[model samples]
Target: MKQNLLLFSIGIWLFSCQPGAETGSTQISEESIKTHIEVLSSDDFQGRKPFTEGEIKTVNYLVDRFKQYGLEPGNGDSYIQEVPLVELTAMPSETMTIEGNGQKVELKVLEDFVAYTEKVVEKTSLNSSELVFAGYGVVAPEYNWNDYEGLDVKGKTVVVLVNDPGFASGDSTFFKGETMTYYGRWTYKYEEAARQGAAGCLIIHETVPAGYGWSVVRNSWSGASLYLDQTGGSYQPDVLGWITRDAAIKIFEASKVDMKNYAVKSRSEDFNALSLGLSASVTVSNEINRDKSQNVIAKIAGSEAPEEYVIYSAHWDHLGIGQEIDGDSIYNGAHDNASGIATMLGIAEAIANMEKPKRTVVFLAVTAEEQGLLGSKHYAQNPVYRPAKSVANINMDGITAWGPMKDLTVVGYGQSELEDIAEDIAKGQGRYIIPDPEPGKGYFFRSDHFQFAKVGIPALYASGGYEHMTKGVDYVDSLNKVYLTSQYHRPQDEYNPETWTFDGMKLDGELLMEVGMRVANSAEWPTWKEGSEFKSIRENSMK
Candidate 1:
């Protein structure tokens, strides 16, 4: 009864939300978003990394809030879903040796190169595997493009570019132009290499094309990584790694191959693999720790139709602590995901106080997203609810940390019908919708929503755009550049009550809240758009 009174008071406190969607209630407040960010990003939480005491604090906080908001447990009277994961800390030798053509080049680990293997083995090695430049390492039959058309890469180490040819060619008709498909992602490159029976794969990391600096590569791969337990079967290559652009250039020079000339040729349809005639050798030993992480789930059961559901998600993990900079060793991830989780929490608090919808609404705080979407992948494969009953997914990765924005940027624009719904609501708030300016980053595929989309659930991952209301576009761009270069994946992501603002995050929260609420109330389901690669998957699931 006391909790009911508090919930009633909460409903009374939050009045007059956005228009056209039950404007009488459920306000997502900036103060609310701020508090969550501050608490989660504080040093006390210890970066919220999985498999740590920090996880306990984070999970308990979420559960307490859910109970206070009067939400029901999503998974059979339990709020926690145990996701099995294996943490592997790969320790490679100090030097990666490349020898051929009377030339020997040694690349230092974490400086000129970084390597790790996902295979569940005590030790793995590349014993002088022949090096092959396999272009972008893409095999898209739909586009008549195959970088490994003729040559065999079995037992060889294939060196590939970062993004696909679309970014290089700038031809809209060819491979979706500057926008990156699944083909451009580093994950795809590694996966394709393993499929071709390659012993190792090393991606040439270019700052611009790869969308982040080499520091990001160094920071992310320099630590223990979490993968779904691979006890059943595994196809991961023995050696998966990255080489600095300078390192790649040196190797090219040693191989007598013109790096510039080959880079240009790789963008064309007729491009083929080039045997650099060089051989690479590196050995990596793994320290594997297998455990389970929790996915916090709570739901507001639908009053009318409880069978159908609408899902909202945010990742709850980040780089815990490493590579101290500026006298800070803690990676707080304030804007990276604390803002996202805060916004989602705000939405949850709002909706929990409101009347239930026609479809069950689930709030999922997934774990280990920083480790290549592993938590969400486990959820997709081992789902609590069937994909067929899932209406749509509204995802918040990193919400706006600044003040209000005039535009909301859809990461994968035109991929799903969710963008259309969001655009209409955004316009009502005097805000516009735009596509992601930096499509080469593959931001869409980087988030947890991509896992849902993989299983044919239409997902939306939109956030604050480059156009801020008070600040201009250039100001937003400059701020983003600084964050990407310095703070991203670094220990400087702590929350600052003095500088960081949450008005834009509040706006985004309210916008997506309405989207989820509307979908929950309606019987109709949103879907993938035409030309989207996931369209057929959704169609098959629906059928």
Candidate 2:
């Protein structure tokens, strides 16, 4: 009888150890997240920048952490994927001359607009290309509207406005309406121009429609612009740039059309192509140097299905040492992306500690996000895993430094079934999902995940709620205003534990882990929404 009891006890113990048996341990801990953020965003990291000493330290730290977690190197024999980059500083032409209506007007270079060239050659010029007013400069067959239909702009410089007409009207049906569609993006405009064989493309900037002021364009475009080496190998375009609305008005006036009339006409489909009867001449000098950066990648392969993959991404680079502001230097970028990297590391640790997932999970800390999402772009173009087999990319960027919230904000909602998984996870914790309030800003296109979306992978980036507890929307809006005016991209951005509430960071991290866990286990695969442009690409990739 004693022997029989011993056998039964052994059987019970084995049953308790079976896979999927409940263990009431927290998946990820708040302490780990706090420690990571504290260390990463601390004054010591020196604002982790690419192509600098900081980048070396940052990458090494990530690799070490991955090693500690027993994650295998994602790349062959190494965790870093090299990216070729070219830094260009286009010395401004003293003046831009517009000739039309028997009048000559010279516009000041930086005051009127900012322009650059991809031509690596020392000298580049746009010699008297005729100016064509291309309404919004968009060509979409599905929308049955083609801005280039009435005019041939083969060698002409096209002047177009930023964003789409639907933006001004806030009509959801209009070009995907209030939410900026890929059609409304500035990148699309430039690419379309290049594809159309246009000599030049200049978008007129307005704060509201562009979702940012001219200063942002000036500051962002002031530095180097990185492009893929295979992208025409330096024969991309002689001119791709932006001009202020005031300069556009000057051009309109020179064309003998009322500036207000053209502004109003900019919104309507009936707005026809107008020959400004003008020509523009610009001569620019280029300083080009090619360099290479790297993306740090680490992976935890699944046992049941190692081929299938899930990815978590965060940019590992930020603005290096820059001009001093308010007596402080070093655009620390602690909140901008250090928080993201920390969150990514924290999540990786959580997944590593848990029972092995059914599908592989990759942790990608990309570089050059501040330089126009180059690192992620390269990865998407040359993925370690088949993007088709990759289930989804859960991207974290610029996570909240402020405290926790009752809600989580998804940048692109209603665009994927992945959101349903997110909602379920949030609902389990009595949290809710909210669409980005400023959809017009195209927040979806601003981060690393955008590269994944461009190539058909379903990607999601969620941020803590901006709504405040004590002072409500006004207070939150005030803080945002301050960040926009003073901190963003400035040296004033530094980590402040006293001011920032990391509880929100922990909450966000936990929620993301939950979402990733759900996706990692499910036999189901997510897809782009029915009408999304990427749906076909995803479907084809799946096949």
Candidate 3:
């Protein structure tokens, strides 16, 4: 009863404090948000995975809701944008052999290492491919750092570190310090290795620098993976994988090199790729399936400048079914993203009733985010609206379900002026905007907003604050820790309307709605901050 009373009080407070209250244009519905999350996260939705019956149901449901809310189809004549994806499911041999100097070592699949092939071939093999230690596998002209300098790694395996030099050295002068530039991402490492003409790329995973455990790598890479189907094959390594730190240590020891000393030396610009005198052999059989996924898009055209757009995006895909735990196989990603979709729905409904702004507003529910932001990447590459005309992208990945808070946390806080607008609106709600507490984890780069950001559009991604209304900071922190360890990416992430609160999620939806409105109405474009790497990209794009 106490919790119920608190929720009622929050609703009343929000109703009184809403910026649109005086004008009576639109009011957010917390119950509607709760209902959307409940249905989307329910068992019947089959976890809302793409390329299955779940995707059919999910997209149809979104289109129905958008029509009910009177939102026009965002695309020319349809609410769905077809995204062509190729699914690669690698069936590796039980064991992989590493041999060098007349000595052989066998690594168990999914236990010591996890690997897959980007090539869409039935059989992919590596026979005694020489292994070289390429530090971080980065070649950035801006940073003047080249890990593959003077090294020819064609038809060989390049062992790379997970993150960049700045993360290891803790120096502000190198690669954005601990903030994790795009160079630090594992995707970047694989791409760079492929560009260097390497046949295989293996990232050495440490929990601290990788920001995730070995279990994540194992589970995520073990199952069927989706990628945008390339017409004539792209520059991707034949084998991309992650080796546990223990496995890497053993490999280094066998190669007669100290892993710790090499890691330290790799942080410096003068470091060169080391020949490990090792060779790797493996064969992977893949079951390849090609399919078309849809990105649900709905729009409210502008009253005046309808060509200019403000995009609101949230991914609608999750890990469908994989290894089971506690007799449950479904990974019902309620908090991971169902909440985010719910927030999007709430924003869409609210905006539908509001006075049409001068610029267009788009609500996009993208697919295949759980498989490395593929949906957003496709949209960024082939947007329905020209990238230059899109004003900004506001992404909501995982909104808080733990009730109201006194502040909001903005991911990628200082990268764009959109955050300034978010902060101003947050202040109007008696809340302040705070930077992400764990910047080292690189939450900003891990979401859909990053796709838009890469294409020179100012994007904003944020979540509810940690300072809870009823419960204090300590409780909120503990709750977050519990969620991260116990529920994140697991089957336990289900919606429980009896216990879960939508107050915080509703607040975040309101903030996003207000930000979208302000951006849509404004004449000026939001640009990246002065020192941001994306600033020049945005300027060039505008030109």
Alpha-carbon RMSD, candidate 1: 7.3
Model 3 error, position 107 (Å): 3.4
Q: What local lDDT score does residue 425 receive in model 1, on the 0 to 100 scale?
A: 73
lDDT of 1 at 391: 84
Model 3 CA lDDT for position 225: 84
> Mind giving the per-residue lDDT tens digits that candidate 2 earns over 1-543?
123211223222332334543323556566666677666655566777777777888888889989998889998779999988777778868888999789898988778877787666667778998888887888876566788886788888989888876676646676677788777889878878776778888999999889988888887766567655453542345787889988988888888765576655866778787678899998878778787888999998887778999899999888878777888667788778888988888889888888888888899999999888989999998999899889889999987766666677888766776666666556656666778888889988899988998888988888666665344566667777888788888877777767877777777888888667766766667778756657777888878
Q: Which residue window of length 10 is worst by lDDT in model 1?
A: 4-13
lDDT of 1 by residue, 1-543 (tens): 122211212211122232223534669877888889989999998899998888999999999888988999989999999998998898998999999999999999999999989887778999999999999999877677899888799999999999988887868777877889878989889989988989999999999889889998998897678888876344668899999999999999999776677768999777778999899999999998999999999999988779888999999898787678999998999987998899999999999778767789999999999888988999999899899888899999888687788888999887887777777678778987888877777888999999999899989999776888878798888888888788888898778778788878888899999888767766567878766768877888888
Off by over 4 Å in 2: 1-26, 223-231, 234-236, 256-260, 263-266, 468-482
Q: lDDT for model 1, on a 0 to 1 scale?
A: 0.86
Give the local distance difference test score of model 3: 0.84
Q: Give stretches of model 1 more than 4 Å off.
A: 1-24, 97-108, 150-152, 249-260, 274-279, 303-305, 321-328, 474-492
Q: lDDT of each structure?
A: 0.86, 0.78, 0.84
TM-score of 2: 0.90
Which residue pairs of candidate 3 clash? none
State model 2's lDDT. Answer: 0.78
lDDT of 1 at 282: 95
Question: Pairing residues by index, what is the TM-score of model 3?
Answer: 0.89
lDDT of 3 by residue, 1-543 (tens): 122211222222443344432313476899999889888888888888888778888899899999999999999999999999998898887777888866688989999988888788887877899999998889876677889889999999999988888896868767778878778888888888988898898999999998989988998888688988874565588888889888887788778555677778899778889888899988888898999999999999998789999999999988777669888888889987998999999999998888887789999999999888999999999999988899999999988888888878888766887777776667777886777888788888899999998889889998776788678899889988988888888898989767799888888888888878877776667778755667777888889
Worst-scoring 10-residue span by lDDT in model 2:
1-10
